[model samples]
Target: MINDGLTDSKFDQRDGIPDAQKMSRAPTVAIIDIGSNSIKLLVARSSPNNSGIEVLYTHTIETRISSGISQAHPRLSAQAIEAGTRTVTELLRLARAYQPDAVRIVATSAVRDARNGQEFTELIETQTHYRVDILDGPEEARLIARGLATDPELSTLNDYLQIDLGGGSLEVILLQKAQIQQAISLQLGAVRLSEQFLLDREAPIDQNTASAIQTHVRKTLETSIDGSLPSLPVVATGGAIVITRAILAAEDGLTIENRSACMTMQEISQLRQRIGGVPLHDRLAIPALPPARADILPTALLTIEAVLEVANADQLTHSFHNLRYGIAAELLEKR
Candidate 1:
């Protein structure tokens, strides 16, 4: 099992009171995550004793703001900027419904990597009247690790690996004995890889192209990952992994809620093969697979499988908590 770093004593000492008694004292907060592929909103409140978080609402909109992000002079297109701004406005409106004590809007790899990223953020700020905090890779990884700590199921884990694959970047965090040893971010995201390697996303990917993508991922990991990773359980989060788990669970005639969190390397490889062999349309027809992810899922799986190989991990446990959760947790702490 993976270690989450949070211990029972830590929780006990956080507030030293019953959660029920502290409920009214907790603060509600909203976090909007603007990513490469989508924009998401999360509204949550701290537990009465401030030892936990209670999710109030969540929503996602596919804006694909990172379109053409792999270009030589990467910039957000006019259409992408407009769509992203509209989505952010909509999500912000939804978040305001809860009258949160604080609201944080953050942008990730896509906005940070794009040459015209600041333009997009400026437009959002101009229209939405909210400051957008652009998170660097390390900060993003740190928040993701903090978010994973909120999961009670993983609270006992003291050492493990965490990987969060987004549309524009991949975040890898290594922790031993509850301390982070390394946090690395790479430009190995599914959308980036797809735009760079897969020229014909609408058609079935050829064997050569598939191999090429895998090779690129492996080579990137080989060079980017500094040293040999310890033999520890891997916990994966992010849209790609969540969608992969949903698709796999649906294939087995099980609901996402009832499916096992543990996914073997073989399962990931098999799914990649099955999805890659089909065209985008066929992948879209698969139950539980998001339409927005249909075109990039194959590449996402390739990257995920590569990560497992590099880590020498046989399986990974999926976590629902991620960056947004971490942001909310921090907001509550400040209150």
Candidate 2:
């Protein structure tokens, strides 16, 4: 029997365990990631380790609250802001219900870009009794690195290039020998790019728009990457990558293993064409793909393609992990 808060008996009773019993461990924590396109919440049972921690029990909500912020304005819309508050309120209720040892609420990209971000933070805490902290680009990059290194599936890829594309900002981190070597944050993402380049379009991804997106993504990557890039494997995670997999499956019944896999530039370009060609309504009906994400898929694919081009990576692997995993990993590490 494990001597920690849980036991072999508890493990045996898992099938019939009550919620309260499941949450009996100490240092239960919740990591709330308020992103530009999504607001994700994760409450996990944590176990401390010399390196970091372990986590279980996670959830996500693709709220897209910061959708289209780069061009529309550097601030969140009232509707978006209110939606964020509501989402957090619900998460707080869940955290309370679970009675975690602690809870950490954080806002990224959208909040960082918003002029009224501080005000929104106060509102969330005042109304929900949860304090919200905003992480800048560099910090965001580092936390993600730690998360990738700690994940059981990804831990094996000692050398890898990680891309996390969100609503307002995209973070890229490089790892070698299981340690972070370089990282950068780009002002490019699916929501804003879609608003800037495709809000009025209805045709499949055309050469003109695809070229423009590819150019922008390349330029951004060039600016961010300094020195020589290692021949590390490219691993991508986040809503955009997940959606891309769904599109690939739609085209050829391709099954993604939820881990980083090799993808060619030509294959990705063909995928871009196929995804852009589909109507928004058609995207909404695709199984495993979220309806709210229908319109943003094109823009997300564009950014991803550009990143691949700049990295000059031969292939990319997709992971089911995202910011929530990073947040949960950090919370557990703290204990």
Candidate 3:
């Protein structure tokens, strides 16, 4: 019995359960990630061969927690809270249909920073039979590192660092020989940086503002990492990188077969200047980038550039695997 919008007895009745997906020996689970920019759902099951989970379904809702944000008090707007919670409920409904053995919901920076973030999560739990796990920046970084290591190429990089740029924070992790040596989480994120420096206004971002943004990012990275970094390959993850990878892949007449993309430092530098200099609306024309991400793309790219400098990397590689994958893999392993 339940008192909220959903009852325990009717958990899997909203949509007929997809028992077919569970027929496989691999145990199925739904990985739901609620971030500052989007609510991502990955319905998957562990592969019997222990290779990787097979994705049964995927969905993303542009909840955009950074929208209508108040930097002064660090509070998410009522609209943002409502939109995020509603999206969570909807995704839970979809997850239930898959008859997954587990439904895991994790919240990132936006929820972790908000004044009433826990209240919002409680609201979702009251209405739906789902719990949103709030991950700290450092833990988030470790999970992202694990997820990146899932990629065959990323695992082979003995001295590689992976960075995930989300709307709320940036996670930098250093891995050596497939083991995470060090990981740090920085406050610099696409949405927060945009709100404070880059795209706070509707007009095109000016050159001075852009320079200031870069200076700040540079200083932050310089102070965060103490020693001189080795010139190793860097890997990127998150929404902005995903979009950037797709765009770069299209330009090179290449296809994303392995769910990863690579670009040289020269290419990334050129992209930061060429695309970051454009006005807001023009950003919509970029391949695979939706309007929801246009305003923050410039800042996201700048942050990536900063991370590369910190790592002393000359090239960037991006993988589609991220936090959601890491969470799913962890649960499946435990199961």
Q: Can you give the TM-score per candidate against the true fold?
A: 0.91, 0.84, 0.88
Q: Report the number of the highest-TM-score candidate.
A: 1
What is the model-wide C-alpha lDDT for candidate 2? 0.72
Using lDDT, give the best candidate's number.
Answer: 1
Error of 3 at 222 (Å): 1.8
Question: Is candidate 1 or 3 superior in TM-score?
Answer: 1
Model 1 error, position 242 (Å) = 0.7
Residues 107-144, model 3: lDDT tens digits: 88888888888888887777775666788988898888
Q: Positional deviation of 312 in candidate 3, in angstroms?
A: 1.7
Flag regions of model 3 displaced more than 4 Å. 1-24, 68-72, 252-260
- Model 3 pairs in collision: none
**What overall lDDT goes with each candidate model?**
0.86, 0.72, 0.75
Candidate 1 or 3, higher lDDT? 1
lDDT at residue 175 of model 1 (Cα atoms):
87
| RMSD score of candidate 1 (Å) | 7.3
Per-residue lDDT tens digits of candidate 1, residues 214-314?
89988887888778888899999989998889988999999987999999999999998999899898888899888988999899998999889888999
